[model samples]
Target: MAEADAFIFAALQQSGMLEASFQGSSWSVSALTSDAFIAIVFQFLTQLQTSDDNVTFTLPSTLTNTPVGVAARHRVGSKLANILKELGYAGDCGYNHFLYPSEKETRNILSCFLSPQAAEAEDDKFAIIQPQSFLANTLPDVPLSLESVSPGIAGGDVTSGDIIMESVGSSGVATKNVAGEENFMQTQLSEETEEQALEQVQKQVDDTEHRIAAMRKVLDRERGELQQVEQHVLETQTTGQEMQKQLARQKQLITMLPQAQANIAKLESIFQKNAEKKAEIAQQMESARDPLLKEYAQLESQKSNRKARCRQLIREMKTFRSDMLELTGVIHSKMESVRALERIHERQLAKLDKKKDCQDEGPMTRNMYTARIMDIIKQVHKQKQDITKILDDIKGLQKQMNVASEKLKRTEAVAEDKLYTAASKSKTSNSGKSEAYVECYRKFAQVRELFEELIVLVGDVGKKENIARDLQNWISQLEARDSSSHLDKVLADLESVRHENGTLQNELRACSA
Candidate 1:
């Protein structure tokens, strides 16, 4: 169990979840009781895109021992537990898995989460934070260091560049002094230490400046609106002031109203007269249009008839064109067939002409043919006699050649036996002998011993047969043993490879963060 705690602690440290100044022995003794754990959870939630905006950054009991503190801890724990389970964490996963887990359980959980695949996933998830870090790092230098940070915030701190969010106690409870004007380090500036107060001050200044500029523009816009409203009011008053003058003009218009009415009456009379004239003219125009209307109807009918005739002609032309295309195709095929048949006919005629030429009147008669047949028959009989005589001579020569070959073989065997008989040479080889001759002599010596032994074995058939059988049995045993040993060697190699692979895996696990 202690080993497991050590392992987990080492892993946490390697993953940069703890500050460099932390020197506690056990996680529960130092990290778990401080704001560090909550900070870590906050980081995890942010990486996962979870809502951790309400997570308090103080220790559980630092706020209060009341139900409020308990509930806050529970909320944070449950959120982290859900994320862990979604990451495929098994076992009794709950709020307690993070806050009340055993050392062994913690080890198991971290082991699963720190796998190579999970590392890659974490890398991608954390990639979105790189730009902020870059900006923070490139910020102007500030006079800050770890020495300036409070002891509580410095203990087990992971990073210097991070957002500044401090949870405060508003009620009767008192939150821990984890961050303050000069105690905390944040990502708004790359420093060994920073304070949340500085970030708030800068943000407040920026917001005030922005608000001031916007308010100024709003003021200008309001001024313009005020001026327009004032001009509209003046125009309204001027029009109101001219109401009496408008009344006098109205009285004058009242006097002229009678004259205008008379004119209106007169125009009405003229309008009535013109209306009657218009009606008469309309009657005249309508009567004139009747004949034109009839003629237009007749023309339209003629146009429709022509259109129908054209449609019929187009259809007939289409049908005739299709027929022509089909007829052309048939003619082309017939022509091709005829040309082929003509070629065949020409070939047949040529063959017949050749036959007639060959059968033309012969130069010799039947008696000439008979004489030729007798001559061929006599010649064939003479050739038969000559062939039989040549065969007899060939047989005699073959028998003589066979006898001579047998005699030569016997003499050569006697000479070879004598030449290769076992004997010893002088201690020193003859200096006059060439290298090839010396090599030949050495071979002759080995061959002589083998030949004598062969002769003896041939004379003793049983001994020769026993030697051959022993040799075959020995070869079979050697083959069987070789196969077994080869298989054993392959198995040994495989076992060695497996051992090496296991060792390499263990080393990799030990080395990885």
Candidate 2:
């Protein structure tokens, strides 16, 4: 029975499926059971098969005939089917009593346990199985122990001591197999974990490099901006220096402003003094003009009075000339009467001579003739006395008219000379005064012309002795012209008569003195 047990254990270990199931649990002796172990081994192998193939396991004939062995096999097969289903294998139990729908392989399972070293040497043969696909089923193959193999089964001589030594050796080999399998699993897990850690470190390195590059670009951009700011600061410094120079120039101008203002004040003072001087001169001129104006008015009044006196004297002279003409006519008639009286006296004398020749006649006739002659002589003497008185009265009136005309002429000449001198003085003094002064000068010139005309006419009157006859001729000429044309002639004749009367009066005054 021990031999049988040894054979079964060796057979289970030799199968690739059983080795993987044992390695999955790290070869823990407590988890291993006869039925569960058989199920895991069969399920693993069945999953390795292709869909169109079938996997077969032939049991010992003695075990298959027993009820307990048959029941155990059935239960193990059911468990195997359940494991195969969990591993994603598709198949059903067949009438030939083997798992169906599996892949085909020619390798013997017993060789994996018999020569574990040989299996390692052929590791390339199963290298296609990925760690993630069969990790739960994978395990290291362990060499079978010599003690676990009965000599009778192997056909070799054996003894009690050999058995004891072999047993010890077998136990040590199993311990070594469990430790080797654990070490192999740890090596795979460590390799996978190292690869993942390397990948994470590489990813971190890439991210850090990218971040550094971005920071460098930002630094370059900020450096460029800082350079521009520095240039602006340099330009501002230059502008500030120029502004300081301008401020100095402006300060110099500010220093001169007070002197300029003082000069302006001095000029303003001079202008004000000049204006005051102009006002003073105007006032003095106005004061000097007042007396000249008064004198001019007085002279004008005197000229008007002189003109009126001259007109009145002309009228008186015209009346005196008419009276002188009437006196001359009466004197001529008186002279004719005196001549007729003398002729009558001569006739009477002749008659008296004839009467003396008859003297011898009577004495009474002689006395009557003497008395008549005496009466006629007395009447003739009275007539002569009356004629002499009339002649003396005519001579006295002519002398008085001549004296009045001479006085009037002399006064007119003095008034005219005074007016001419006044006009000349006003023309010189008031030349720039006003328009009225110019008008006064023109009036003075007209008066001068009238004075000249009167002087000529009065000189002619003085040369004429028959003043009445000359006046009569002038009147006759005036009457011959029209009234309108004779107005100027009449005025001229009146002015001549006035001048003649003025000359006569002046002469009379000279003689009387």
Per lDDT, the best of the predicted structures is: 1
lDDT of 2 at 298: 97
Give all candidates' CA lDDT scores. 0.58, 0.57
List candidate 2 stretches off by more than 4 Å: 1-271, 340-513
Candidate 2, residues 1-513, lDDT tens digits: the string is 344334435545554445454544244323445444444444445434532255343223333222245565665556544644454444443211222212121012222223443455479667877754453354222123444766685575665446545776899999999999999999999999999999999999999999999999999999999999999999999999999999999997787688998867977999999999999999999999999999999998987787566556545544544554455455445544544554454456545534543452332232344454565566557556755665576567557656655764565555556545555666677765435545654664575466558657745654563475568557756764656743664466556666666998999999999
Query: Can you list the residue pairs that collide in candidate 1?
Result: 19-156, 19-157, 161-187, 162-187, 184-194
For candidate 2, the lDDT comes to 0.57
**TM of each candidate vs. truth:** 0.22, 0.24
Model 1 spans with C-alpha error above 4 angstroms: 1-268, 280-284, 287-295, 325-329, 332-336, 342-513
lDDT of 1 at 383: 56
Residues 116-235, model 1: lDDT tens digits: 435675888878677657655764342154357776775656444432212113321333344442345454454523566678889999999999999999999999999999999999
Residue 353's lDDT in candidate 1: 43
